[model samples]
Target: MTGQVSVAGLGPGHEAQITPEVSAALAGATDVLGYIPYVARIAPRPGLVLHASDNREELGRARAALDLAAQGRRVVIVSSGDPGVFAMASALFEAVEATGRTDIDIRILPGITAMLAAAARAGAPLGHDFCAINLSDNLKPAALVEHRLRHAARGDFAMAFYNPRSASRPDGFGRALQILREECGPGRLVVFARAVSTPEERLAITTLAEARPEMADMRTVVLVGNSHTRRVGGWVYAPRSATVSAPASDPEGDA
Candidate 1:
């Protein structure tokens, strides 16, 4: 209603995937702040303002949105997937709190998260117990990331890895594969989904030892199947129950 800031999730693909609510909010928003690609996803509307920036400026971008809200201007901090899940929502609120600027009312609208989208596209890969982890060490230490990776691998939990690898941090993915091989064994199934849901999307399903860390990039998400993951329709997912084929039909009796 009144001037406020909303953190909107744009999903993993182009504009069509975004919910109607997010689209409306973006239309009404005086300004939208986010990464360049995310901003470009939405068509240019009259009287709408766009503030695109590099990935590292997420915190600053959120702070700007909050400030605009404080001035009675509608703002939206857009992210690729669900705002709260490894997106800009956390930084937006944290900056507002750190600045002691609570005057701006904030709203967060949910959207199709990459992990969930990947699961649906790859079959029921997440039907069972699973966890989401970001492989990038920009916000956290590599040692801490390694510790978490080892624990997840040992627990045999299905894992959806965000920001799996990038040009800048090439070794992160390699280190993860090494740890998973040691803890989950070499034969464990893993799924490599790149630019998922987009035109350039690519998928590779393979075993832990068979998976190549070099296959990942900034726009990729890697799903590490648990002990139960199996191949289905060219993808890998964890099945809830054992598969059973039906008995042969009595064709002669029907005739």
Candidate 2:
């Protein structure tokens, strides 16, 4: 039997949100590796081996899975959301490149990401042009994050944020709110969707002026509307059509 590696997503939180393709992959996996929380989602079986590691061990985990596959094990690497969207798929590819293992058979299975799930729950805040940004500075610099935030805001694009805040870096999201308020103004809509599709799920809609940093945490996915986003009845949405004057080009050479 040929060794294979399947990097699969398990969806946001609910089992129902997981795609049939990913579930099927999990069922046939001889070995599974992932973050501790994600690996816990898989059921134990007679021939299956589960490897759970800390969240910071992504690169190591990816290499381990590849090694297992090289040994002819049907390995599956699981992530909470879409593997391609801020998850294991990228890490797996990076490991493949570092190890010079181009011959490995790898499959990237997609699932509903937290951003899209939150958008659906909020009545389509991302109905128009949008961009998703991860605010954590663990892998990238903070200056780059603010630069992207300003550009995205200036372009009148709706925005989705993942890993918005944590205890150690609580001040970052507060600074982000300040930047958004300056670029998009006080009246723009902001949605805070936490733990979507789960029992503890929460959805809050407010204007940028009223938004506070304390409203968000690690589990929360923050959404900012373009200038055209508005509320219809009890739901918030960004209209399909928008009419806005073009923003001025950056003075620092960025267009």
Candidate 3:
């Protein structure tokens, strides 16, 4: 049958926040492929085959899911956040596209992204227009990250940063801060969310200048505010965009 396959979001850090539909899809799945840490977040659902892999073998893990799907197994490829949002969905599609095989049906059941989870936990700081950028240079050049950061500042759009820092890419976090500072100013609101939905979760609301590299990790996501986003009542908030109401036209008279 080449069963319906999916890259499921496990929610940011815990099993409780997993959506019922996603959980059901996973429960029905014959196999699941993901990094070891995210795989550990799932409870032992019987009859499910786990293909846990080391974090570094992203492509390998994704290929495992594709292989399982090709085998007519209801396979679920899990990700920490929404699979499409800086996660596994793209990689899966890319892999299939490279192989020139789109015969397998793939579905993406969305889940709570880390940025959204963190934003809601604090406040609606992303109420306005926003963009998310991955700071990791492993896939893209650091210069490209800097260029995007510069434009985001000039456009005055709120931004969420994914993969803010890691041991291999130690300079991404600091460099992002530097570009934002150069484009904006020192007082802009920046929130650092770590281990969202997990026991070790930490959320810090501070300015760009005050964000320290020591607290950031691969799980960390940084939200850098536009000029409008403000910190009040221990929360970060962005005001709604202004919209001018159009003058109502008389239905019959205008005609």
Candidate 4:
């Protein structure tokens, strides 16, 4: 398979956060494919073709990258954060699996995801056990989101949430905040890291009682600390270790 398809992460809005491996993939790519804003990060050069599409077209975009590779084009699918983390890598693999394509070289180049970036900016709230949850209900049922939130809270796991709000689903985040308040209580720390690493980046650390739903938009990544999470100075973090406790049962009865 001379033709290759590389799924690369551009990191969270900053060129500095992009990994060297992803940079190499982009350099060698003949065709770059991704969402409009992600693709716009790449500079136009001779022999490189840019294919920008709208959001919510992951399958189509993945297939297009695969088809281009089949035609001997060195294609790279760019994702804003790590392609593996709720990004193009999964969609690309899904397309490859469905097609049973064994004739093309496929590579997944990882990048620093938004959660990690946001966590770093917020002083390591994910220093201990953590779970990353995508709060959007576009692909999954809304009930599952609440279920996962409850489980994560019951597990006492630090959580990083993505896609907290969007124009079509503004109420979902508010409901999520409500579920968190019910489970984690008012004193739990929440960090709203908006546009991390970008010029418009803003970080707000507050307790659940003080955290308003309006603080988070689509660009924001919200982090909720476990029961033991606390602030040292200006930073919030969960310690590396925690005392063992009996596992909490799910509030919802098993069917």
Give each model's clash number.
Answer: 0, 0, 0, 0
lDDT of 3 by residue, 61-104 (tens): 77777778788888888898899998889888888877766898
What's the residue-level lDDT of 4 in candidate 1? 93
What lDDT does candidate 1 reach at residue 218?
A: 83
TM-score of each: 0.91, 0.96, 0.91, 0.95
Against the hidden true structure, what lDDT does model 3 obtain?
A: 0.82
Tens digits of per-residue lDDT, candidate 4, 167-241, equal 999799989999988888899999999999999999999999999889999999999999889999999988888
Error of 2 at 5 (Å): 0.8
Candidate 4 weakest ten by summed lDDT: 246-255
Give candidate 4 misplaced runs (Cα > 4 Å): 245-255
Task: Write model 2 residue lDDT over 71-168, tens digit each, in one string.
Answer: 99999999988999888999999999999988889999999999999999999899999999999999999999999999899888999999999988
Over 4 Å off, model 2: 246-255
User: What local distance difference test score does each model get?
Assistant: 0.83, 0.92, 0.82, 0.92
Pitting candidate 2 against candidate 3, the one with the higher lDDT is 2
Candidate 4 clashing pairs? none
lDDT top scorer: 2
After the best TM-score superposition of candidate 4, give how far the Cα of residue 161 lies from its true spot, in angstroms.
0.3
Report the Cα lDDT for residue 254, model 1. 50
